[model samples]
Target: MDFGLTIDQKSFINEIAEFCSAHCKAIDINDLEKRGADPEAIEQKLAAKSWYGLPFPEEYGGSGRGYLSVGLLIERLAMGGYPYPGRLQITMLNGLNVLKNGSHAQKMDLLPKICRGERTMSISVTEPNAGSNIASLQTAATPKDDGWVINGQKLYSSGAVGERNIIMVAARTDFSVKAHKGLTLFLVPSTRPGLKFTRLEAMGRNIGGLYEVFFDDVWVPNENVLGEVNKGWSAMTKGFNVERAIVSAGYLGFSERIFNHTVTIANERYGRNGDSGKRGAVMSRLAEFATELQAAKLLTYQALRLADREKLSIEAVCQCKVYGSELAKRLGDFCAEVAGGIGYRMDSLAQWYYRETRIVTVGGGSSQIMRNVAAAQLGLK
Candidate 1:
């Protein structure tokens, strides 16, 4: 497959890089981990630039760019030390799901707010008992008069921190049915009563930290049902391919940055030390990482292209997510080794990456879960 970037794509990437350089300084992950940064200003800046709407259709006040364009923009932003902007772009995934399964009124009311960055969205799937095994989620939504009353807890919901966010929560709507069959999605506003958010302390990238959200008799209107009741499992899973592709792009971008930083550290340490053996070995390892990074990039781009064409295969997205996430972990470890004593410092990029790398493996889906998905796609029993 040709990996060439179109002229317009190239120009767009340059524009993103320039904007990131002007507005965002490289984040100090250590500081962020201690006390989360306020994302309000950054969110507003990205909104003003229309970066949040890159992947949505123009009718929703978006740029009408394809998923591939969104992935490329995410990569460029991350590489330029502007990872937070990409978080805002994640609303596009929610927007896509809403467009596919939401009522026309729901779409009209939500998509424009998402596109304009007037609000943020999060997918609340993981519960205490369900991380990769989405079918086992215990959140319940019982039908009430003209609405649903939801009661349950969600864990590690990333963007559900503040009042301006809306979470797409998965709950069991029919307990008599099988776990997967009973599941349904609801669009719950964070400002609604009976909703409580408790922030969780994390190792790195804590700009908007993970949260444990409890919905105690939280009421949602009938119109807020995200898709057909009792069919949300399919609606939610249908968007995983695109979400995984974009996540893979973010992992690839962050890994590329880590790899470059390691190279610079290696060169500075041994480039002129006359220690030929050590220098050569370090260079060789860097070369291996570079090769892996390139392979991950290709896989990510292929997945994005397929998603844009509405032909994304489950196995393809799984492969991209699995390989790209694992590569980032490995790159982080290699950076730590190359940075030696300095890497142990809290402020070191290597240390920050090492702490953050595990999130990728666990967040979108675990490595084991991705492998299971790939095996199932291959008709494995």
Candidate 2:
């Protein structure tokens, strides 16, 4: 019933905010090809402070802070405009996936390094052909002598380009069984032979290094298999509930920053024109966004609450993901509209947000798929 954070939690959020203040500036990239604040360096700094383990258990060198704390951590980082916000979210969830599905030796070897920031990870699910339809994936892994040869193309595998990165790739291992049952998950090292990462130079994704990971007959030993072969559907979807809950919070936070900036600029610019009628109407429009933002916050927080109890509801996760991502998308356009010319500049965060929010809606699950899932969960076809 309470909608408040404890004193300790509030202070912890403040500490995270302060810790990130130095790295919280808008990305700076010169025409000379130099960019600001290496994403890896910032990640390592966060790791040194044990932040990458914000939601992990302590036995694996994590802080054991739980999912709700991680949601807050992600939101704060995104609010600060930290460039690697998406990467950190996936990094944390990838570790959680390994913990949930990896073998004991795999866990012992990887978890410590992951939590310590010596290594990073990403999940390669949505292939070019498989966006929302998991059953439609065509990527295949064939059994060879003592290992498996993987050959597939994955789209939108965020953060898969880093040197120490390992990607959890989903591939079909059998064709005779049901589509979901025939799939397997593998932890493929980013630097492994036959794996190529081509940066997708689309708008607003440079910060996350969104890439299409191509596997040209990559080989992985049996030990690299995550969970059981022909049973990867569960392992693949294990992180989505928490991802919707936590990553959606980041969307909310980024939306909040963009919303706040728009209001400031709108008020200042509109006030100067001395048109009280126009200014009042604009403020009312902003009020609508604010109300929707509150709704998003409630849904996201509820999802986080359920995750902490390990009772995450499919409906709750879908609601948060759909509403939060849509809000960001709509809010970005509105913010740009209200800010007018000033919002278009590259130095400003508004333009980047304008591009990024459009892509967020389709990342975890598309808004349409989210709605369908929520309706189905409620016994609706």
Worst 10 contiguous positions by lDDT, candidate 2? 29-38
Which residue segments of model 2 deviate by more than 4 Å?
Answer: 29-38
Question: TM-score per candidate, in order?
Answer: 0.95, 0.93
- For all candidates in order, the CA lDDT equals 0.83, 0.81
Model 1 lDDT tens row, 271-368: 97758999999999998888888899899999999888889999899999999999988988888998899999976777877877867787778898
Model 2 lDDT per residue over 73-124, tens place: 8877777766535567778888888988999999898888888888888889
**Angstrom error at residue 219, model 1:** 1.2
**Which candidate leads in TM-score?**
1
Clash counts per candidate, in order, are 0, 0
Off by over 4 Å in 1: 26-28, 84-86
Candidate 1 has its poorest 10 consecutive residues by lDDT at: 82-91
Per-candidate RMSD, Å: 1.8, 2.3
